[model samples]
Target: MAENGTGVVEFVLMGFQLQAAQGMGLFIVFLACYVITLGGNLGMILLIQSNPRLHTPMYFFLGHLSFLDSCYSSVIVPQLLETLGTHKMIITFERCATQFFFFTLYASTECFLLAVMAYDRYMAVCNPLLYTMAMTPRMCLGLVATAYAGAMVNSVVRTGCTFSFSFCKSNHIDFFFCDLPSLLKLACSETSLREQVIFLLAFLVITTSTSVILVSYLFIIRAILKIRTASGKAKTFSTCASHMTAVALFFGTLVFIYLKGNMGKSLWEDKIVSVFYTVVIPMLNPIIYSMRNKEVKEALKKVLRRMKVS
Candidate 1:
């Protein structure tokens, strides 16, 4: 076994090296993505906060989702940008653990939050008479709280389990950040138990949330079909189209990366997949939600007008 602590203080991340010859170009691209991710999510939050008209259950959930996206992107992107710029991919053990913790937390929370949003839609469309009472402000607060709590618990479990294992090998993490599976691969001890635990957790979260969202949407579709007016159906569907797109993209990338065996994939391949969930999805979320929703546009205009007046 390698010396316990003497090998290296920091693990070097080998971020997208396939296009290594064009380091400057990749840096520029990621920089632009980071900027847009931050600005878009922040703008959404600001718009929702400033507009009284947006003070409803749907926008309430959206505001929190935007905030989570901002936090999620911020957790990974700045470090990634630095790696792209300097090609110095060193990350300290403590920093790596912290990054992995928050990344897992926010990612898991997003899964639950998306499910909650689907439930909100289901209630609004399928149980119109009881929608307000069903999705009360107190209920909304509780749902958001549960999402965060679940995320924190999952983060603690994953991070605690990963770090508890002894790391006597080389400290080089092949990817940009301390991803759970990559870090697991480095542990000196056997990871059968850890793998089992993680797989179970993944199954529980993904299957449970996906099942709920799917069932809710089934009811939503039935209710939409019952609407006699074509325009009414269109309007109702439009409200959820953005969310459905987001759910598809987010879960698709997640399953591809985590559910599949990471058998022969290169670190470069892993980083590319990581980009979809870590960076691209968050950047696209605000645009998808805002562009598709008339209320958000009106909120934006109102906020811009207020800013101009000030």
Candidate 2:
């Protein structure tokens, strides 16, 4: 028998490892962030839905991205809020596994969605003549469906592998949520193969999606340079600005957290960085899109005015 217990019934989420007072402070801050994440993502979705002008493929993908961000934040942030309160954070095996599965699903889906958006932008900017015909509503729906399917497959594989192992080693999870990386660390069985698989999956998701985005940008930039007028080029570039900013923020944080090095040594640091993707980025998306996208801004204004009038 160990000092803690013989068998682990539930995993104790060592979320943030802050004092009670500090936890309370963070709770307030994260609560505000969660509210913003929900509001921003849902607002963007409704804004896109209501405005007939936003019926284009760009807004179509943007609306889906916002929905993913909202769901992603929802999966992690509410549990995080619970941990940030006065009580010790404990999640049952089943609930933790549920969290891990859905979070991965949403995260992976967002990655693929971003790549698809980049390709859409590339075609729109570089091959505007064929944009409407090629990116038809049917094709757009197929792409979104494909993204969800990929995420689901990956999530099922990961969660099944992760929970298959016994956790007699320790029940203390070092991160806020039951992420694959953190959970894998606690496994008593052979994790070398599982870790390799995870690393490969990470590489495939990050590299493949990032490659698409990069190549799409290359063609887009080339097309812009060929535009003779500076104003026309600026207008062309402006179309991609929000997505580029979003990609930079999302993938930048993702690369920093996963690829930098040694997650164990910087688990605490990684937790902080994790907050950006899980909480902050969702909130930032609508603001970024609304600010950089003139159409979205106008749509938002019109929506607000109608609400006020009512």
Task: Give the top-scoring candidate (TM-score).
Answer: 2
The local lDDT score (0 to 100) that residue 219 gets in candidate 1 is 96
Worst 10 residues of 2 by lDDT: 1-10
lDDT of 2 by residue, 1-310 (tens): 1223334568988888888888899999999999988988898999999999999999999999999999989999999998887565889888988998998899999999999999999999988899899999999999999989988988888787778776887888888998777777777878778777776787788898999999999999999999999999999999999999999999999988777645747676788889988989999999999999999988989988998999
The TM-scores, one per candidate, come to 0.94, 0.95
Off by over 4 Å in 2: 1-7
| Model 1 C-alpha lDDT per residue in residues 1-310, reported as the tens digit of each score | 2234533346767766646668778778888998999899998888888778889999999989998999988899989888888777788877888888898888899999999999999998888899988999999999999999988988888887777776666676777778877777677777789878877787778877898899999999998999999999999999889989999999998888888876235756677778878989999999999889898888787777887999
Best by lDDT: 2
| CA-only RMSD, every prediction | 2.1, 2.1
Whole-model lDDT values for every prediction: 0.84, 0.88
Candidate 2, after superposition: displacement of residue 249 in Å? Answer: 0.9
How far is 308's C-alpha from truth in model 1 (Å)?
A: 5.1
Write down the worst ten-residue block by lDDT for model 1: 1-10
Q: Candidate 1: where is the Cα deviation over 4 Å?
A: 1-9, 18-21, 263-267, 306-310
